[model samples]
Target chain A: MALLQVTDLKTHFFGRRGVTKAVDGISFDLERGEILGIVGESGSGKSVASLSIMRLVDHPGRVVGGSVHFEGRDLLKLGREEMRTLRGRRMSMVFQEPGTSMNPVLKVGFQIAEAIRSHERVSNQEARERTMDLMELVGIPDAKRRIDQYPHQFSGGMLQRLMIAMGLALSPSLIIADEPVTALDVTIQAQILDLLRDLRDTTDAAVLLITHDMGVVAETCDRVIVMYLGKIVEEAPVAELFDHPKHPYTQGLLGSIPKIDEKQEWLAAIPGTIPNPLEVPTGCRFSNRCPQVMDVCHHVSPELQVVGPGHRVACHLYGETGTVDADA
Target chain B: MPDAVMETRHLVKQFPVEGSRDVVHAVSGVDLIVLRGETLGLVGESGCGKTTMGRLVLRLIEPTAGEVLIEGRDLGALSKRELRRVRSELQIIFQNPFASLNPRMSVEEILRRPMEIHLRISAAERSRRVGLLLEQVGLREEHRNRFPHEFSGGQRQRIAIARALAVEPKFLVLDEPTSALDVSVQAQILNLLKRLQRDLGLTYLFISHDLSAVRHMSDRIAVMYLGKVVETSASETLFNDPQHPYTKALVSAIPVTNPRLRRERVRLTGDIPSPIHLPKGCAFHTRCPFVMDRCRTEGPVLQETGGSASHLVESHLVSCHLVDPA
Candidate 1:
């Protein structure tokens, strides 16, 4: 069985304006020792889906319908106490900004050790040793002296390393990182990304890396899921997805990026901005901006259908004749 | 007018550390020249002083030392009256459109404010020009009544671009103008900027941490590390054949969009040393993989590299003791 299997997940936010469908009927499976990338723009409900799976959504936002099955149990069906225990043990989440996630006053090592102690009854000394080991493993040099330093003392790259270490405190089987290196500088970002890749090789943990950057997704992720307006528009292996993006949204995203290898006078920019969540379009989310948008695309929403081996795309281009591949 | 639209000679900015004897070495000695109708990309990691360099070019902040000349006229030497007059010649577009523009002000008011100060025109003329500016920036004239809050992030950025173009500035300091937007939206904004530059024949100092975006926009690219211009070359050549170790690491670090083309990463393993307390020689020496014994004591000067130099900016320039002089 897959490590984590999410089926028809629906997370909605109740507001004064209206019910905003953040993660609407999204389903995917993550296997052990795999890094699955969720790529999308802001308000595409990528972050909310991860939050839903973690059961960390607050009062206004609730998982209206979903089954996040992890280790033979439905995560959404678990009680408050049971769900709390599952988190930071079976699975853990790493946020975008490292500075905001950590406390300024507390020592960095102490906080990392605290994560371990929270899950298990370990002695302070034992936790401290493990923290130093994790720090060293994550490539933070001179861990002995740096352990006593506060979060403010650490640079952006160091802090992110600490965050990743905290995520691995309990040897969690699954890790969900949201825009992990977005806030970092390119040099530092490369270090962090390389570390994450290294962690995947060293550990059995399945990582769900959520990011807006296509280059990051291509570099790190083994598999890619393109999301738009709370729906999976495309899903494929990195190579196949990049080379043959069936959906217009995915194609637009690929075309929009200014490639470093070659020089082009003008980019194939998708015309309009992402529509507001409150007033979603009747049919396709990307129809407003799609260059090759058809008349039917403006009214009828296409279902995610398998095109090639392990490749799935949702668009009107492959209409009724599209076959659903059970293996995908 | 000179061939170069804007030129900076030995620009330096050192911010005094609060409650400490130390100073943040924000921008060390640097020289740059932005040619007319060309986009000069200033790329670096955060705290590398690309933004500070842009600000210094516009005289937004007083540089500790150096000269900023626009069309052979020194910004520092200008009197208050002369500065006011010269202000119309240069303009800046900041990163965040939401923060840069006033939330309360209407789109028309925001665009017209610059024209009102710079251009000696009637209110009626300014109003008509506001409509023209709105159209020029891909924003509708009907959006004139809308406040900043009502528009989307992309629309707000369009408004910001419109405001900058209102005064008809020859030189534009675009400091991460598209960084705040999404990729699709960012593409739109970038294209808009390129189109505007072409239409107005405006010179641009495109400062951004985003390498890919900078690669798309700039005619020539300069790689900065810890307030120093470590390397400068023609846009395509720099990426294809990066000479400096710092530049190589930076180029290598950039995630390849194509999975098939993943290159071997040259990792820089060390803490990014504090700018406040720089080392004896290079600021990047601690983290530099190719750090030599000489690099520990003596800094390298920015010199021309052994490349086919057709023009001044296109001539590959790198700062490293190892690189053979042209």
Candidate 2:
């Protein structure tokens, strides 16, 4: 069985303007030791989906329907107390900005120890030992002295490593990292990615990596999901998605990026911006900007259907055929 | 070859630390020349002085030493009145459009202010020009009355571009203009900038940490490290045949969009050393893959490589110990 399976998840924000369907009817599964990437532009509900899965969405937003099945249990159905216990113990999260995510005043050692103590009924001394071990495991140099330092004392790269250590402290079965290295420099980003890749190899934990960067998805993810205006538009294996993107939105995103290897005089820029969530188009959300958009696309939403082996796309163009070949 | 519209000669800027004699070497000795109608990309990670260098070229921050020349006229030699007149020809587009633009001002007011100051044009003329500028940047005429908060990030950026173009500047220093926008929106802004450049014959010093965007927009690219220019070459050559070790690592680090074409990343271990207390010789020697004994004591100078004739301005130059000075 897959480690985590999400089905028809719906998360919405009830603002004064209207209901913003942030993560409207999304579904996917993550296997053990697999890294699943969720790619999208801003306001596409990728981040909200992760937050919804973790039950971290605040008051304005609520998880309305659907189930997040992890280890044979439906996460959405769990009670608040039970969900709290499961969070740091079985599933943890890493955020984009490590500096802001961590408590400013708390010592690094105490934060890790606290996460351990909260999840497991361990003595303070035992938790301290575990914290030190985690620090060493995440490759913090001089783990002994550094553990006493506050979050402010550490550099951006080191703080992110500390966050990883905290996430790994309880040996969680799953981790949902939302733009974990986006705030970091390219060189530092490489280090964090390497660390994550190494963690995946060593531990049995599955990672749900969320980012806007297609390059990061190509490098790190086993399978990828392309999100648009709160819905999954495309899903495929990493190699298959990049090589053959059937969904017009996915194709446009792939074309928009300036390739470092190939020098093109002009990039195929997708016209227009992401539509306002309050006034999302009745049919396909991307129809307003999609180049290959048809008249039917403007009025009818397409369902996510299997295109090739382990590949699925949601678009009217593929509705007629039901499935497209991997090469096509 | 086109004459350099703007040039910097060994420009340096250092911020003195509060409680110590040490200084933050923000931008060390650097020489750069931006030719007319060409985009020169300056790329580096945070605190590597790409932004400082861009600001230095515009004389936004007074350089601690060295000179900035615009149309062969030294900016430092210009008096206050002359500098104000020169300012119209040189403008900057900041990273965050939301922050750069005033919250109280509407798009129309923001666009018209530059023309009022620089052009000495009538209000009617300014209004007409603002509408035209808005249209040029792909924004609608109705957007002129809306406040900055009302528009999306991409639209706000378009407004920023419109403001920059309002004065009819010949040179612009775009500092991470699209970094704050979404991917699709980023492409839109890039295309708009390219069109505007072609239409107005604008010379740009494009400053960004995003290597891919830089590769797309730039004719020539310069790699900066610890307030120093490590390499400068044509965009194609720099991306394909990066000579400097730091440049090589930077080029390889860009996550290639295609998984099958993943190249072996030259991973540089350790953080960029604090500029306040820099390493002995080469600032990048601590992280350089090809560090040598000579590199530890002697800093390399920018030396021209083989292909000098083809480029419009300087030859393909790199500062590294490995390159033989033949």
Candidate 3:
């Protein structure tokens, strides 16, 4: 069985203006020990999709439809108490902001120990020792001395390591790290990514990494999923995605990056900014700014169709594999 | 030699620790030269003093010692009125436009208010310039009437750029102007800035942590490490053959988009040292991959690397013992 799978996940927000279909419908699966990356801009619903799978969407936002299966069980179907038992134990999350995610008042070590104790029955001494070990595992030096210090005392990089240690407190099988290294310096960001890679090598921890940086996705992930305004625009192996992106949106994204390997006089920037979630375009979400936009793209939503072995794209330009009837 | 549009000589800024004699060496003894009509990139991690350096050169914050010179005129030596007159030739664009611009002000008012103070033009002239500014920044003239809050992040940044250009400033300090934006929007803004620079003959000191963008935009790049510039070279030389240890790690840390083009990793072990308690000799010695005993006790100074740096703009200065001694 796959480590985690989502089918037709739809998460939307009920605001005063209208329903913002943040994650209208998306589907993907993660294998054991694989790093699956989801890439998109601000309102592409990549973050919301991760939140939906964990069943942790906040008020006014809900998972309207979806089935999230993890370890041979449907997480969405589980009761509140049942889901709570699995959370922080079988699966866990690490978000972008380390300073806000942690409790500012508590001692860094105490907070980590509290998480461990809440999930499992362990004595204070045992939890404390385990917390230090976890801290050291994430490359925090002087873990013994810095254990009692508050969150403010730790640097940004150390604080992020503490968050990762918290996620690994109970030895989760799957980790949903949403922009884990986004709020970090480049050198520190590289170190944290290496730590995650080491974790995968040493254990069976499948990571569903979410980020807006295509460079980070290219370097860290095994497979890539490109999302645009609540839908998957393209999905493929990391190498295939970078080399041969069929979707115009994907191509635009790759070209937008300022690569250090070479120099270009101008970047092929998409024509317009992202449309408001409340006022999405009719047919394809990216049609408004797409360079190769077609006439039919204004009225018919294309389906995700396979174009190569294990590669899929939801673009009219490469829809010969599974043609969608425009009238339907 | 190309004339230095802006120069910082032995610049230093120190902050005192609260209720203590200890001090934070924010920007300590740095020298930089920004050439005319070229983008000079300043890159480093947090607390490397890149932002503080930007402020120091612009005279936004008074330096503890040393001086800033613009076009051979020492800004520190200038009288208050002289400094005010010189301010019209210098401008800045920050990362967040929402913070710099007032929420209640309309685009025309925002563009016109600066002109009223700096140019002292007639109402009709100011209005004409506002429309021209909007059109040049790729925003429609209709957007001049809209409030700042009504525009998107990308469009608001364009307004900020237009506001900077209203005074016809020759030098601009762009501090992480695109860091807060998305990748695609950042590309648009970068391209627009390049176009405007060429059209108006502007000199830019582009400070950012993004190395890729730095490589694409800079004519020369300076690498800072803990309040000091560790390396300065032409953009291509810095990326292709960086000499300083800190620069090598920083350059390698930038995630390349091509998975197959991974460079030899020069891994740094620890986080950036606190500026308040920097290491005794080299600030980066604690995290450097090639730390030696001499590096532990003696600090290095920036010097010309080899024979290739003949031109002033192309000089490659690296502050490392492994390179040529000054």
Best by DockQ: 1
* Per-residue lDDT of A200 in model 3: 85
lDDT, model 3, position B105: 89
Instruction: Place model 2 in a CAPRI quality band.
Output: high
Using lDDT, rank the candidates from best to worst.
3, 2, 1
- lDDT for model 2, please: 0.90
Runs in model 2 deviating more than 4 A are A121-126, A320-328, B307-314, B324-326
Q: How big is the positional error of residue B229 in model 3, measured in Å on the Cα after superposition?
A: 0.6
lDDT of 2 by residue, A114-225 (tens): 9898788999999999889888887788899998999988989999999999999989999999999999999888778888988999997899999999999998899999
TM-score per candidate: 0.97, 0.96, 0.97
lDDT of 3 by residue, B1-326 (tens): 56999999999999889999999999989999999999999999888999999898889899999999999899999999999888989999999977988998899999998888889789999999999999999999889889988888999999999999999899999999999888889999999999999999999999999999989899999999999999999999999899998899888899999877655679988778778888987777898878888888888888888776568876999888788553
Model 1 residue runs over 4 Å out of place are A321-328, B307-310, B324-326
**Sort by DockQ, best first: what order?**
1, 3, 2
Residue A280 C-alpha lDDT in model 3:
88
Candidate 3 has which clashing residue pairs, if any?
Answer: none
Global lDDT scores for all candidate models: 0.90, 0.90, 0.91
lDDT of 3 at A153: 93
Looking at model 2, residue B271 earns an lDDT score of 86
* Least accurate 10 contiguous residues by lDDT in model 3 chain A: A319-328
